[model samples]
Target: MSIQKEDIDHLLNLDKIKADEKNAHIVIDPDQCAACQAKPCLIVCPALLYTLDETGALNFDYAGCLECGTCRTICPHLKKWEYPRHTFGIYYRQG
Candidate 1:
């Protein structure tokens, strides 16, 4: 099924979403990741925070991140991708 804003809200509604808006916590080096042909992180992220821009460049939005660390493990470009520090990222109670 296609995910809509309401669907996302419904899913996270029951769970507590503690956002650390002060910091992005997760950072991506598009220059380095650009070399990666197979971007599994784009699909592995449950929150679907990773997306492609109109120019086909990698785009990432951490606003609705679940901080599941899926991107960290799936991405081959380890030189840039990383999870937030302790208690510095989005926390989903059960989302």
Candidate 2:
């Protein structure tokens, strides 16, 4: 069966993210992001974690990360990508 937008939204709503304020699982280089012409991470992230501020600087909020690693695969400027330590990350619920 083909999945629709509502289906996807429903699936997303079933998941939860518990952020670890002291440690982040992903890191990106701002300097590299600034020089890059194509910012695929802005569009490709399922969690919508990547964003651009009014000053044109890239901002990433890891709190809601799906741990899907799409940003790591898409962003050339990404400095580090790893699973969140221990008990902090996405919790998928049965839908």
Candidate 3:
């Protein structure tokens, strides 16, 4: 279940995002979220996109999210957040 170069390459190919590329289209809303007390997003996020700050506030690392939708589904509150840019977020392979 570890990541590899091909996974990264595949995502880049699909999203057309080159290495060291900038995905300005990627965005996340910390304030919009209710910051689920359980914070299941942290556990379910395969890419560890959801994390907490020193102050315990939600810190969203969009780049690491696999766009798995686990967070969206697990959240009792759907903040109606948008998906990562077409070529943005984490990429993966079966191997």
| Per-candidate alpha-carbon RMSD to the true structure | 3.0, 3.7, 6.2
Best by lDDT: 2
TM-score to native of every candidate shown: 0.70, 0.82, 0.53
**lDDT pick, better of 1 and 2:** 2
Count backbone clashes in candidate 3. Answer: 1
Candidates in order have lDDT scores of 0.71, 0.81, 0.56
The runs of at least 3 residues in candidate 1 whose Cα sits more than 4 Å from the true structure, single-residue gaps closed, are 1-6, 78-88, 91-95
Clashes by residue pair, model 3: 15-87
Regarding TM-score, does 1 or 3 come out ahead? 1
Instruction: Give the count of colliding residue pairs in each prediction.
Output: 0, 0, 1
Sort every candidate by lDDT, greatest first.
Answer: 2, 1, 3
Give the per-residue lDDT digits (tens) of candidate 2, residues 1-95. Answer: 85454665666897887888999889888889888878888778776677899998888878778888788777766788899988999899887
Q: In model 3, which regions exceed 4 Å deviation?
A: 1-35, 81-95
State the displacement of the C-alpha of residue 3, model 1, in Å, after optimal TM-score superposition.
4.9
What is the TM-score of candidate 3?
0.53
